[model samples]
Target: MAESDGQERTEQPTEQRLRQAREKGQIPRSKELGTAAVLLSAAAALLMLGDALGEALSMVFEQSFRLERAAIFDPATMMPALAEAIGGLMWPLLGMFAVVLVAALVGNSLLGGFNFSTQAMMPKFSRLSPVNGLKRMFGVQALVELLKSIAKVVFIATIAIWLLWSQFDHILRLSGETLNLAMKDALELLLWMGLALCLALLPIVAIDVPFQVWNHTRQLKMTLQEVKDEYKNTEGKPEVKSRIRRLQQEMANRRMMAEVPTADVVVVNPTHFSVALRYDKDKPGAAPVVVAKGLDEVALKIREVAREYQVPVISSPALARAVYFSTKLDREIPDGLFVAVAQILAYVFQLNAWRKGQGNKPVPLKDDLPIPDEYRV
Candidate 1:
């Protein structure tokens, strides 16, 4: 569906998208960097352990050539000698291999860290398609890889040739030197050559690392619609969120209406607004709190609930609207409207008292209640 949109991918990927890609083992990695590191590590290991390696190799050569009368006649004796010779050769090589392995792992980890994912190990049949294979072989990525390979070859060859040419005089005189001196000269020359090659590779690694990162980021670019879709997936679809909000409002209204029966009075703006106020003499607040409030149809419902529960319904348009707008449900009415609500509550109490024949009938509530001018609207 996203591909069908034909939207150009321009935006940088979000963190979630990047994280998903990482989980799938799709992370920037430069093969050149790992190759260079392994090469350098192997060269360093050989240089550091040169004496020990030479001794091991000499032992292997000596063992292979040394023939005792028993070793020459007995095949079983020969097998043990051959095995000892092989073990001598393997030790130095194994040390070099270990160094190379460590270097390769460190180089790869420097860029993308360590991520073990089976998703990358899974094979896809699409890789077998000729068209896809040709595209991969001749694509921009392939072209870039070809260029990098050519550059690396040229750089290494140039360094090697330059080093060898500079040491040509020394090389020609090697035949006149003692065996130990000749061996030392050759070792030094090889070390210099290896160092030169390693240095040459540094530039290629520098360029390839940034190129790999850029290519990976470009491939992960997101279209505008994709961003919106991802947002919806992570947050919620707009319509679904709206429906949820509507359901929450309905539930809140039901709960508010349930509180109407316990309210001392329901103040109304005729048929438009309604606010149910409740006051507890033992509560800390000095004024009544609005327990329920609604507008229009909800107001009608509040009034009906109030009547059904025999709660007093007072017509106070300004006070009702003011309380409904300014006060939150289950919170005390603002100080500005305290006097007005107090007078209404006093009237309701008096009416109740009169109904039970305990007090004189209260006068009708005045239109001009003690509501502040600012709260009039």
Candidate 2:
């Protein structure tokens, strides 16, 4: 199991952790699986190609002895004869090599798929330290490898002893047979023994493959603190994000409060809600826009700023609540409230005129202004 700061690693690795491990060339592999696959493939190839290979060998042997007495003494003729013999065997050897090479590649890729990482290829200077080297030499992995080697040796030895005991009579009969018959018999016996050894490896491969996968996962497991650390690195720390959002909210509130002073009228629910609207006279048909709005404490602050700037403060409970709930800052109030807001704006204009002694005093505004049912909070 993996450990961090004396804490046992108990959590499964995350996708990011697995991906990073792959990037570092850490992946599960079973040497026994690869060995079994290669051996089995070699046995299969030899079984299929044995006749042709045997024929080639027979032909080479026949040619080797068919030389004239005078030609055998000639160096030039000897070299040519040896070259022909070697050339005859080359294709069969190459064919078997190809099959074994493919088997090895396919077997090794069974667990981890294919990965090529430069970091895996790079040598670490830390590995050269005597202390590190000693630890590795006596590690759990080394002990496991030693046990596997001993098991393999024992298995092969047992198979060899059984084959020798069972084939004692056949071996004696081969000695009395003709050279071709003896060679054929020997080849068949060897192929069957090779197949038996390959079969024995199946159990080891099955056991080792699962062990390698489990060991790899155990090595990559994360501790609780490590998981938390990784989360902070990847998704960011929660408290820091909370702080940032708070700062952002404060900045936005400051900007909204600044707009409150510039509003034409500050409509209020008296204590709980406040919505400030501004009309553009230059755009004659344009609806009044909500410049600032707030609930409770923010509402009180907006009202304070409005008084400081000498903006008109109207106590219209329904209208204030409707605008506060339905409209965002700097957006026009909904069409349903257009008539109600227009009435308020007209009263403000007339009251301003009266204050300057330019017109008669306007009538007081009504409390039950029109508010859409859908917008009612």
Candidate 3:
């Protein structure tokens, strides 16, 4: 049994959920996806930057090595080659962008049934509030952001230290060379630095991906009123209690008649209402309760099935209607009819005892209750 609190608890709106998620330092914010795009984009940008520096050093290093003649590197001759190289690389770069875009979309989708809304962007002048700005600066979210920054610095420094140790021999090797050679070497170092940067940024990326999803879910939260509205839409408007009761009774009658087998007796109106009653012999002084009841054609089906099952069919029209109208299935017979029903049950039990050849047991019942002649069988 539920205690009546009279207040129904419903879900909160998406914005509140998002605001809470954000406060908790949950990751994968919307901008993080954009950040992933930037990271991947940086990879391509680094490649180009590395290439330009490499070419400048190539010019100086070629002269120092005395290996070949320097035909001044011309844009006109190299432009086509550059275009060809870019075309070759385009597929992979596009794939990288696509992966980030899809990951962001999926993470966002899972966090909430994420829906895009510009409503969040529809103009706010909250920047004027110095108090809110101060709160944001000192908030839990600000703390998380500060932690992420510290982690990135630590990660990058560790990688750089490792790189220095690994490349110490090369740095010490005396290759009599010019500024071009130094620039080329530095460019090579920067290429590795880009990778280390991406690696260092990975934690922030991981964190933000989840936050983005959480942020999206928060935007779609359901307020109490919205929860009720959606439920009503799904379940349809509530029906009157009386109508619900009637439908329940009708369904019960159909089910009851289907279980006419194994009943001890069925009290009937001969042509109108029929009710099948069953009693467990273990229970004493308790009259059989109605298991199935029907009026009109359904009543006829109950009698037909009762006859087929060879259950005793007692014609007691007044009792049949009284029990059918006054009691519910699986409940005890009502107080008013307890004595009359007990006698009928006793008579039925004696008949069963006689059939089993136990003894000649006399029917143990009294006359029926007085009722209208029209309803009497």
Candidate lDDT scores, in order, read 0.87, 0.89, 0.67
Give a tens-digit lDDT track for model 3, residues 1-377.
12254433335544445555445544244554455556655665556555664564465454436523332366664566455556555654565566556655664454334555555545657966899899899987799779877876787788878877887876665265566676677666666766666666667667777775665455455556666676666556667656888899888777787778867899888989888888877887766777888789888988889989899888877888888887787776777776567677777878888999986877545455644444334
Per-residue alpha-carbon lDDT of candidate 2 for residues 40-107, written as tens digits (9 for 90 to 100):
99999889887767877888878977999999999999999999988989898889999999999998
**TM-score-best of 2 and 3:** 2
Which 10 successive residues of model 2 have the least lDDT summed?
Answer: 1-10
Q: Give candidate 1's total backbone clashes.
A: 0
Each candidate structure's count of clashing pairs: 0, 0, 17
Better of 1 and 2 by TM-score: 2
Clashing pairs in 2: none
lDDT of model number 2: 0.89
Off by over 4 Å in 1: 1-6, 63-77, 176-185, 242-377
- Candidates' RMSD to native: 7.3, 8.8, 13.7
Pairs that collide, model 1 = none
| Tens digits of per-residue lDDT for model 1, 1-377 | 14666878889999999999998999998888888888889889889876666676667666767787766789888888878877877878888889989998998788888899898889989999999999999998799889878887888888888988998998999899975566666776787688778878898888889988998999999998889889989989889999999999999998988899999999999979999999997867457889999999999999999999999999989999899889998898889988898899899999999999999999999998988888878
The model with the greater lDDT, 1 or 3, is: 1
